[model samples]
Target: MTADPLRIGILNLMHDKVDTQLRFTKVLSEGPYNVDVQYFYPQTHYTSRPVPDLVQKISQPLDLKQVATMDAFIITGAPIEQLTFEEITYLDEIHQLIDVLVANNIPQLYVCWGAMAAANYLYDIPKFQLPEKIFGVFHNYLRAQDPLLKGLPDGFLAPHARYAELDIDKIMEDSRLVINAVTKNNFLFSFRAREKNQYFLFSHLEYGKDALLKEYLRERNANPGVEYIKPQNYFRDPLHMKDPEFSWETTQRVFFDNWLHSVADHIATQQFVKE
Candidate 1:
């Protein structure tokens, strides 16, 4: 008998989590599995004020029970600062959630900050630290062929924006996670969760042109005391440079499609046994 479609639950932790969730859904839905995305937002902001009701309305907190019911779950990055992994307020909850997913053998994916969260939870590595904020389309080299990048080009670009970054050397030390892709600058990375058939990326694969623009503006407004100047000042005349043919949105969809296929294959094989 044929199995039911794979049900996916997305855990969005960022202020713009819903946007990323929707973009991911759009890409995954085009694949074989039935995609169902859910958003999760934190209660406090970097400044410790309650997130506005409008933003809160878009996402709800997720628990282990809720996560157990899904075939797969995805966690999005957030715009928060952490000197150390433990310093993050939601670190404990994220760790618990990851444990539950791993213990239950649930497939999962994490993007950007979500990647950092998984690395910290699984390897006890500190949060990524960077000398400057990374933004715009970044080039990454694929190490080996995996189902996740089945039909995509050999090299691709993804959107990025983060002051902190992970140490690739430390990530390499952890055998549980497999490094799928890396950048020449070593600022971006992608991985697959071997035990759970999950994936993680340290770039924004789901961000569209407008979404990137909004992020640029938000970063500009926040003025996080970083000396890095805004892209607008440098690329003022050719705004489309932000959304080149090798756009993050386009390449991200390819990555998302690969995830859907992995989920579909897992569901097909009846390998998703709940713990």
Candidate 2:
């Protein structure tokens, strides 16, 4: 008999909301299993900024009642990495949502700032500001054989664009968290809390080929006077922005496919136990 479609929810907090949804949806749809995706945003945020018409058509304000029904959830990264946790206007609402997810034992995948935020809120792993943004496609070496990274090779390339780093020492000291992957510089790539059914990815595996390029251009235009750093090791010709390689395409497909498989296994196991 065929299994039910995986009910996955995404709490998208990125500025380019539509692109974020599309990229993640593409990766999530790569596997064999059917996936039902629910997109959400912080209602408190919309109260201040005008909700984009496209966002309104595609997503809803975060609903605690509905969040519990998801088999798995993804929280996307925001551009607001410079701000303190308390400085975030909608943090309390997000905390409440996370608490509900925790209470329901929902599997979570926190990407970039979302990962940092969740790490701070749940495990007290504080985020420290970096002198400059780590903007590039870096090689990430696998450190553990976690189910989430089942078929991936020893190393893979992933995009990074952040101004903060999670306290590595604190995470290493925390017995509950398992460090899965890290860069040669020892910057974290991915980690998981087995007890909480949570995964944290500092790198952007779901980024499209032009994602970083668009970000660079957008930032450049937004602040014409300010000198912006081009995404390193990304453009074939840094001057002209020539044919960029989609190096992480296969890696993302495999990673997200493994994640879905892992989630499916967890669901099956839970069902078996309940039976």
Candidate 3:
């Protein structure tokens, strides 16, 4: 018999949605599990213009009260990394999301800025601003064995576009968190909070083939005065840049498949315990 679809909640905080929906949907659908996704945007994120298509896909304003409706949830990185969490208009609402999702034992993934915010509110870990944007497709060394990194190389490449870094020392100090992945620069790339059944990933493993290149171009166009650097190891030819070489597509699919299966297992356990 076919299994019921896993219902996932997504909060697309990216201003330029582009292929966010496709990447997410495609990745999650890879494993044995099938999924149904519900998109949401915190109403307060309206300060920036929304992607027309993404805005239409959003099911409704985020509501923590309906936490029971989802088997898993995901929050993507936002462009507001330069601002403090409290300064964002949707702070309270997002906190509500973090609290309710955890309280109800929902398995979730928070990428980039969303991961940083969740780590902060949930564990008091701080985000450290970097002198320059950490924009690139970079390598990550596995710090420990994690199901999330199962099918990928022990040290793998993932895409990143951010102006800030997570407080590594503070996060390491949190006993509940297990460092899973790190970059050569020692920046924490991914970690698992075992108790919370949540994963905090600094890199955007779900990026489409040209996501980083697009981000680089957008930044350069917005501030012509600033000399934006091309993403590391991305260009087809460093001398005469062409299309970005696709790196993480297979690994990304593997990671999402693992996450989906894990969430299903966790939810099944939660339900089993209550019976």
- lDDT of each model, Cα atoms only? 0.68, 0.88, 0.82
Task: Encode model 1's per-residue lDDT on 1-275: one tens digit a residue.
Answer: 22566667776776665566667667776665566666665433334666667666776756578888788888788776445665677677777788888887778788788888787777765665676677666677887566777666666766677778877777677777677877777665687756666677787777666665677667767786654434432233354635434355557666676677776767767655532
Show where candidate 3 strays beyond 4 Å: 47-59
Which runs of model 1 end up more than 4 angstroms from their true locations?
A: 1-3, 42-52, 224-228, 231-246, 271-275
TM-score of each: 0.83, 0.96, 0.92
Per-residue lDDT over 74-93 for candidate 2, one digit per residue giving the tens place of the 0 to 100 score: 99999999999988988988
* Cα lDDT of model 3 by residue, 1-275, tens digit: 11788889988888676477777777777666878887787876665776355476645777777665788889999988999887888887888888888877788899999999998888888887899888777888999899888888966888888888888888778799999989899877899896778899888888888788778778889999999877888887877768678887776877887888788887678778999
Which structure is stronger by TM-score: 1 or 3?
3
Ranking, lDDT, top scorer first: 2, 3, 1
Candidates' RMSD to native? 3.7, 1.4, 2.2
lDDT of 2: 0.88
- Candidate 3 matches the true fold with a TM-score of 0.92
> Residue 190: error of model 2 in Å?
0.6
